[model samples]
Target: MVRGRFAPSPSGRMHLGNLFCALLSFLSVKSRGGDWILRIEDLDTARCRPDYARQVEEDLRWLGLAWDQGGSAGGPDAPYFQSRRTAFYEEALGRLREMGLVYPCFCTRAQLHTASAPHREDGLTVYPGTCRGFSPEDIAAREAAGRKGALRLRVPEKSITFTDGHLGEVTEYLPTDCGDFLLRRSDGLFAYQLAVVVDDAAMGVTEVVRGADLLTSTPRQLLLYELLGLPAPEFFHFPLLLSPDGRRLSKRDGDLGLAALREKDSPEEVIGKLAYLAGQNPTAAPRTPGELIEHFRWDTVPRQDIPLPPGLF
Candidate 1:
């Protein structure tokens, strides 16, 4: 069975962009007689809160975007939250370690962002393998010097190419595109790339529907899948729903978060307006998720970032 997941990081309340991703993921999976999983990505407990996660569940329920499994609605795969899945990440990291590809990286942010550092077009400063060949003695010396290092995997100078379900072909060269990315943070936390891949594979997720802003992350994730010997899911990264002023909406700024929007609009009203914004509805009239599914088309959804119509709410 084809299973898709809507994994959201609950650092804040759900915004329009968050809603856009949730709605599209739900519709795409449901339309195909597949199952949907709602995984709460609370790996960063410093920012993630129980209240925020509860609010996300409340918002999705209000819009009637029901999931077959995950979160409070548990399935065969219990403990859907990332915070509860550290052991899995550790095991995967251990596999990489056993393969002799893992190494300690003590490079500071300033050192990495130097003027001579190679950067991808997306502005991610490539890790120049500065600590790629660190020996146990070198690591001990750095530790003796009162310095800690994050763990990085050694990546080959190879290109990873994959076809995105919505955007077609995509390619990324590892050495320059995003060389030897982090598997764990220096503070002893698992990286998002590693955690997500582990959780998805364990939960049997076959498809991933998320925002277009995460398109560049797919190749790195694909590589992780290859090294871990896990099956990678097909991706469909939808375009971002921009603010009226053409700026990306942030949960930090409370940009049209559902907590406040729900007070002013009915659930159907909110879902309908979101549908209109995604080109799935003819007008911004009240409509339930059930009503919008008949018109939901991957091709009809705009391929580029869409700016909200000012004063439409």
Candidate 2:
């Protein structure tokens, strides 16, 4: 059976862009008679809130996008929240450590910013391997200086290739593109790359459908899957939903959030608008989730970022 998921970070309410991804993910699985899972990616405790998480679930329910497993639904894999799954991340980190593929990185954000690191299009700076070859004495010295280090995976200079369900074949070099990346943060929190890979594999997720913004992240996650001996799922990265001004919709854009949209529009109105944006429907007429699924086609979805039509809200 094909198992899919819509993992949302509950730092804020769901925006139109987030709803677009969730609807696609839901339709892709449901249309094919597959199970849909809803995983709350509340890893960043400092920013993630219980109220936001609760609101997220309510919003999805209101939108008529339900999941088969995870969150309140429950499944074989319990504790759907990433914050509650730290032990799994630690175990995976321990395996990497035993294999000599993990190292302590003492590079502070200020130090990294000053370093001549290659910047990716997504705005992430590639690590310069400053602490990749750190010795025990070197690490001890840094610890003595009251500096706690993060854990980084020792990425080899090799290329990785994978076929995206929507975008076709994609390739990236590990060391050159995204050098030894972080598996754990300096504050002892597990990084997204590590946590996501571990959770997907453990939960038996067969496919991953997310935004194209994360297309560059697939290669790094692929490396983790190989290192941790986990099966990498098929990925489909859809185009992002941009604002009328060509900016990506975010939490800062409060007017574009579900909380704001709910006050004026019905669930069908919201779903219909997003479906039209995703190239699934001919018109932006109100439609149910099941009604839209009949027209959901990966090829029909645009490859480029879509600008939100004027007066969409």
C-alpha lDDT of all candidate models, in order? 0.89, 0.91
- Local lDDT at 53 for model 1: 89
For each candidate, what TM-score against the reference?
0.97, 0.98
* CA error at residue 33 for candidate 1, angstroms: 0.8
Q: In model 1, where do residues sit more than 4 Å from their true spots?
A: none
Q: Write the per-residue lDDT of candidate 1 for residues 184-237, one digit (tens) a residue.
A: 988888888999999999999989999988899899899999999999998998
Where's the lowest-lDDT run of ten residues in candidate 1?
252-261
Cα error, residue 102 of model 1, in Å, equals 0.6
RMSD of 1: 1.2
Pairs of residues clashing in candidate 1: none
In candidate 1, clashing pairs total 0
Candidate 2, residues 94-210, lDDT tens digits: the string is 999999998989877888887477887788898888897778999999999999988899998899999999999988888888889899888998999999999999999989999
